[model samples]
Target: MTSFFLIDDDVAARCMLATIIEDSDLGRVVGEAEDGYEMEETVIRYAPDMLIIDYLMPKQDGIETIRRLSGLGYAGM
Candidate 1:
């Protein structure tokens, strides 16, 4: 199963997506964060194979989050 990381501002959205992904056999939820700033360490620690991120979030938007993740050498799809 594909390991997945979720990044979203809403706790409910993250939970919902995790459930849907797992329930549909799309992937496995490895970790989650509420925003970009809170995700750096978790991303590195979990090293998920896929990332499903929100387009809009506080502290840092998806674009910035992508950049940060890229800078950290993450190649998750």
Candidate 2:
């Protein structure tokens, strides 16, 4: 099964997305986080096949987070 990791400051949004993904049989959520700061370790640990990140966040935006992850060699889609 495809694995997914979710990143968003909004708890409700995360929950809704997870539900949709699971209910639709799209994938499984391996992990989740509210912000991007210091999340590389967890993301690396989970090593999910995909990452669903919010474009806007309180601490770090999605683009920056993705860039940072990419720099650290996180190749998730």
Candidate 3:
């Protein structure tokens, strides 16, 4: 099964996306984070198959998050 990690500042958005992804049988949510900064280490731990990050966030945006994740060896999408 496809595993997913979510990074979004909006709590409701996170929940909705997780539910939709799970319900659609597209993937499973393995982790979640409020923002890239808060989740850097945790996301690495989860090692999700895909990362759903918000374009805009408090601490870090999607691009920055991906950059950080890549630097930390998280090669997932």
RMSD (CA, angstroms), candidate 3: 0.9
Angstrom error at residue 46, model 1: 0.8
**Candidate 1 C-alpha lDDT tens digits along 1-77:** 89999999999999899999999999899988888875777898898999888989988999998998899898878
Candidate 2 deviant stretches above 4 angstroms = none
* Candidate 2 global TM-score: 0.95
Clashes of 1: 0
| Model 1: per-residue Cα lDDT at residue 19 | 94
Q: Candidate 3 regions off by >4 Å?
A: none
Better of 2 and 3 by TM-score: 2
Encode model 2's per-residue lDDT on 1-77: one tens digit a residue: 99999999999999999999999999899999999988988998899999999999888899999999999889989
51-71: candidate 3 lDDT, tens digit per residue:
998999987899998988899
lDDT for residue 8 in candidate 2, whole number 0-100: 95
Scored against the true structure, residue 69 in model 3 reaches a CA lDDT of 84
Q: Give the number of the best model, judged by lDDT.
A: 2
Residue 64 error, candidate 1, Å: 0.3
Q: Which parts of model 1 have CA positions greater than 4 angstroms off?
A: none
